[model samples]
Target: MSPLVADELAQWAQYIQSATGIYLDGSKGYLIETRFAPLLKEVGTTSFGELLRRTQVDTTGALRRKVVDAITTNETSFFRDNSPFELLQHKLIPDLIDTRNRSTGAVRPIPIRIWSAACSTGQEVYSIAMLFHELKVDLKRFDVRIFGTDISDRALAAASRGTFAKMEIDRGLPLDRLGRYFATDGQTYRVKDEIRAMATFRSINLLEPFTFPHKFDLVLCRNVAIYFTERDKARLFGSIARVMAPDGTLLIGSTETITGICPQFEPKRHVRSVFYSLKVNGS
Candidate 1:
């Protein structure tokens, strides 16, 4: 495999950071080389530098798309973290439902929109669908819409298909829930259409302006912002706050904190997990 050239690192890193808001340090050159080696060989490029130059010259942008897809991390699994989903099942969703029920001017089919930002390969999105299924929420009475978005077109394509390998199904998903929510086909599993219908997947760059027509009731932007610089993190959470309902809930990676990043949200502890709710008056 060809190594990433020493001098090309800064140029590639800057381009990646500028395009995706994902900071790639010098140490990540090996990662870039490993990911691109196959593509480099296929495209007849002998060095990463040559490949980079070709991508720059490709005005059609196909090579650029391939480069971007290679750089974006798509690591994910169903219920990858138990705390947030547990919080959703035990507290958050129930509370939101109660609030919707109590509203005097509530419309028929209470609207429940959930956005899973950076939902790579659809695991988290499918997991949310399973959560609702387990809750036995009468879907006929509620307009529950789940949106899963990621910057990688390749990831979104896989997510939209709702298929998972046996290994992926084993990770973080309980055997019984897996049996309940998915249909086995040979060694792989596919999310059942009923659950699949509850969610939609699309390519979204969080750094870009908001394009979704409606605000969400619950937003899960987990484990993704760790890649962004502090400024990008602030912009991301700020944008999320703008599109989140005042009483809406946000779940981020367990180790991630918004204290110094975005002040629009206040951390709220629930049992073993933490979720944020938009603070009134930006407190």
Candidate 2:
């Protein structure tokens, strides 16, 4: 395969941003090369520019999907970054339950909805489901629905399978929890049916327009936004704000803040975590 040149890099960067809202600058030429090398071979393209041209002209859109699958980062692990889950267990869940109870006293089958945006490979969704199981929350009394969405179809397909390799399970997943929540499938671990049934996965592009029939009580749009430009980041968060319940909690990457980016959300702190909630007035 021919090396990725400056012109090809610029073209790919623009195309990626237009299609997926992931901003890649001149520095990412190597990333484009490395990620697309295998793809070029599979597609029988001789160079990055050839692959780009094929993707553009492929009316079936299969190549475009492949490009998206290759370019989007799907790196994730079970309970990756411990603090957000901690916040969910210690503060967010309790607060949500209390608010629900106060509004509708002793309502049976209380509704709890969560959206894990960019939920790569389903680890985060299952992790949250496991946390709820560990908390001993009565599934019979809660209308719990955890929806996981990502732009990559490959990632969503893997997520829907709820199967993980041993190496993946070893990352941030404890042995005891693993035994309780997963069933042995030869060399891999499959999330038990009970845990698997609690979540659903779909393909969604956060940079594009979308709507849910119901608003989420907790929204986890973490880490993925760092790849977007400032304007796109604002657009993404602003869209997230509209789909969140009035008192819903938003957990971003530990290093991220929406302080000036989206003023509709105000920061709140727990023991070691920071979460956001909508201001008194809606955005």
lDDT of 1 by residue, 129-151 (tens): 88888888889888899999998
What TM-score, to 2 decimals, does candidate 1 have? 0.97
Name the candidate that leads on lDDT: 2
- Worst 10-residue lDDT window, candidate 1: 1-10
Name the lDDT of candidate 2.
Answer: 0.91
Note the Cα lDDT for every prediction shown: 0.89, 0.91
Question: What is the per-residue lDDT of model 2 for residues 1-283, given as tens digits with 9 covering 90 to 100?
Answer: 8888899999999999999999998898988988898898898887899999999999999999999999999999998899898888877887776777677465678889999999989999999999888887778878889999999999999999999999999899999999999999579999999999999898999999999998899999988999999999999999999999988989999878888999889999888889999999865
Clashing pairs in 1: none
- Candidate 1: regions farther than 4 A off: none
List where candidate 2 sits over 4 angstroms from the true fold: 105-108
Query: What are the RMSDs of all candidates, in order?
Result: 1.2, 1.2
